[model samples]
Target: MSELSKQLQQLQREIKKLQRAGTVPAAASAGDESKVRFTAKGFVSLRSKLGLSAREMALLLDVSLQTIYNWEAQKSAPRAEQVKAIAQLRGIGKKQAKARIAEIEAAQA
Candidate 1:
């Protein structure tokens, strides 16, 4: 392969290594509070799962509406405690977050 191609391959391999080591910033293991990756859609899912509007969720989370909006827009994420509260509010264990994701995906099918 060309030198550039080789470098790209090396980078890809490094990324894979990081991902396997659970080092990717967005890839969090179940119940790993410190590694939780909160996406905008995740927030929306929790809100839907709990039948909560944005305003209601903001109230319950004790955060400004803009903060919630920012999260949903991928501008920012909640802190660990907030993530735990969201998990609890959705009637989910931290490990079960993936299951909820599956449910969300299936519902859209």
Candidate 2:
């Protein structure tokens, strides 16, 4: 097999092991519903699942547009704060944590 094919095969095996151990979400048996695959490399399967553009992701992430471009191009890695924000947007953080939480609460009341 070609190097890329071998790499993909390896990744598939690793993903299967993770699924068996309940560490990763397995692909849907029906192949209709999208699955979120969280690998150890911090490359969540958000791009394929959400179909969001880089600019949209940057806006959701509250980071600079250039930052997103840099990340996509591998010119830079996400800083700690950016990583946290991404995790939050990905529904991995405390839901109530928001930049304008106080304002939102006041408006609701």
Candidate 3:
């Protein structure tokens, strides 16, 4: 009834239509290991899924905290090199993420 409810219903209808058409949603179609398209929402989701703080993610990505914030806020996007790093990160588990952070820190030290 409300505007938000109407929007949600419309989205549901669209999703069903896409499903019937055999089209995978971009967010759900990361099956290809060779390439990935970076998106602000995907970046945020990956970071959250790994349980990393913004600072930890920044260190892992070899970028500044401000840069992470900017990406998550959709203020700017990662460069091609950074997107490659992000794709690698997205495919790893939480334990691997921690190990990577440690590896980066050890290398820096």
Candidate 4:
């Protein structure tokens, strides 16, 4: 038991060091979903960064066009599940996002 505890402690110390080095997002290592926050600025920035239009973002996020507009306009916030979906989108690049959009359109066909 002592050996196992020591190994766990060592792993945790490594994680903390990685976090401090900015290699890991703090909330991710902390396992706290509530640490995810929604902001219109962030939403729009992420949308434009992915080179996606509002409609494309809606498709990628499995939301409605109006919902995309609402989020960008700060008229409303995403639900918890939607927030998780949005968080997942943060890691991908434009090409991957476009591919995902294509998948969505194909499925809709």
Which candidate has the top score in TM-score?
4
* TM value for model 4: 0.74
Candidate 1 to native Cα RMSD, angstroms: 12.3
Please, what's the RMSD in Å of model 4? 4.4
Q: Which is the better candidate, 1 or 4, if ranked by lDDT? A: 4
TM-score of each: 0.49, 0.41, 0.65, 0.74
Tens-place lDDT digits, model 3, residues 28-65: 44345346688899888999999999999999988999
Clash statistics: count for each candidate: 0, 0, 0, 0
- The Cα local distance difference test for each model comes to 0.66, 0.53, 0.81, 0.86
Model 4, poorest ten-residue lDDT window? 19-28
RMSD of each: 12.3, 13.4, 12.8, 4.4
User: lDDT score of model 1?
Assistant: 0.66
Sort by TM-score, top down from the best: 4, 3, 1, 2
Residue-level lDDT tens digits of model 2 in 1-109: 5999999889888877875664543333123332333232353355334555565566566677787777766677776555544544453223223333444446659
Worst 10 residues of 2 by lDDT: 29-38
Residue 107's C-alpha lDDT in candidate 2? 66
Please list the residue runs of candidate 3 whose C-alpha ends up more than 4 Å from where it truly belongs after superposition. Answer: 1-35
